[model samples]
Target: MKKFWKWTNLTESNPTERILTLNGTIAEESWFDDDITPQLFKSELNSCSGNITVWINSPGGDCVAAAQIYNMLMDYKGNVTVKIDGIAASAASVIAMAGNNVMMSPVSMLMIHNPATVAMGDHNEMQKAIEMLEEVKESIINAYEIKTGMSRAKLARLMEEETWMNAKKAVELGFADSIIEPDKKINEDEKEKNKASDSILFSRRAVSVALQNKLKSHYLANAGANTGTDITDLEKRLNLLKP
Candidate 1:
């Protein structure tokens, strides 16, 4: 069966690193009838011997799944690095917290909110659901508080508001550790020689992608922009920058 969550160790260089790409909805799409459970994630974690970089782009899912993933990541022997390539929200945000270092593209987004549930019963059942949800919300806050060191009250309020933050805002609020730098060109021969098979090279490449993104944003925001450069000069500069 096809796997929704991809886990692989990039073991072709000096210091191998694991690459886990988590796209789609967390626990929403299952490859097997009952996969992506804690045991499954634990098994995958056991396979890797070094640091793992998780690339997350998800709208979140199954709080329990997120909690399990978060715990496994925290328990891993090697450092956990998270990169938000697109969006991390709801349960997915919880997984992001497992990161010893979290990075996001300038355009990426992070979202947090109170947990919810559906219960069918009398008033007692309704009340039970509320209590359960409250407990879950607290658990979610634990992750956020540890990462941001924000007071529980403020964090709760943000969650209550379902606050969504851009990469810069995420960093300012302490959800993300850093923003990717703008994209920069790398030499073909040097790139081949430094092919990203190790943590150091992989990291360098991540930064390069960040820088490249920033460069694109800069060019778009400055297109026909009248900062100080004139039109003809701007055109010339843009032409010169063209690859």
Candidate 2:
């Protein structure tokens, strides 16, 4: 059975954080296949106790599997932080809602739309399929509402419109808590240092200008005392030294 998730300890010794990477399609196993089950996922999840950081990069598949994974993450004892490093669409977005803190890479995207399925039947059977899809959509919206605190009506509309969000838009709409900007602290520190350097440079320039003025005044006074050098020559010499 193909596994969609991989677990890794972030640190080798006395690790305090774990990483769960969910890439590609959510569940590769056939729906009827029991080889790769949520129970197996749960066992792996419970193998260790630590904060979990889930990195997701999926186009989504198997809503049922996604739902089970979402529930398991929600029930986990440690804090769950979800980082969307690529696109999380459809059912994948539902799973993202399980995070206590959801973050997205600056270039990552998230998409939501109504659930779809193939159905071949008479009018009555077609109606049943439609009804089932509607119910599934509502179930997906439940997860969105819990995460975003948006009204059901609004969430439904967004799903209907197939809303797509970048990291900034996701944060603005409460779909994500923040953007995953690497080296943010280091960038901020660099900015502070640049500001300090600029201030010092400005101060040095001011001192240089003040000293130039003082020297010019003293030279002018000396020229006046000597009364021999032409005033134009003295002015030209001072101008040559002007900053």
Can you give the TM-score per candidate against the true fold? 0.71, 0.73
Candidate 2 residue-wise lDDT, 57-155, digit = tens = 999999888888999999999999999999899889999999999999877989888899889979999999999999999899999999999999988
Q: What is the C-alpha RMSD of each candidate to the true structure, in Å?
A: 14.1, 21.1
**Over the stretch 1-243, how does candidate 1's per-residue lDDT look in tens digits?**
334488877757625799999997877645234654556778878975888889999999888878878888998999889999999999999999999999987678888878987699899999999999999999999999999999999888888767787777788778989877558766788556533231111122334447666766676777776456555555566557543
Q: How far is 212's C-alpha from truth in model 2 (Å)?
A: 70
lDDT of 1: 0.79
Q: What overall lDDT goes with each candidate model? A: 0.79, 0.83
Flag clash pairs in model 1.
Answer: 181-210, 181-211, 182-211, 182-212, 183-211, 183-212
Evaluate model 2: give its TM-score.
Answer: 0.73
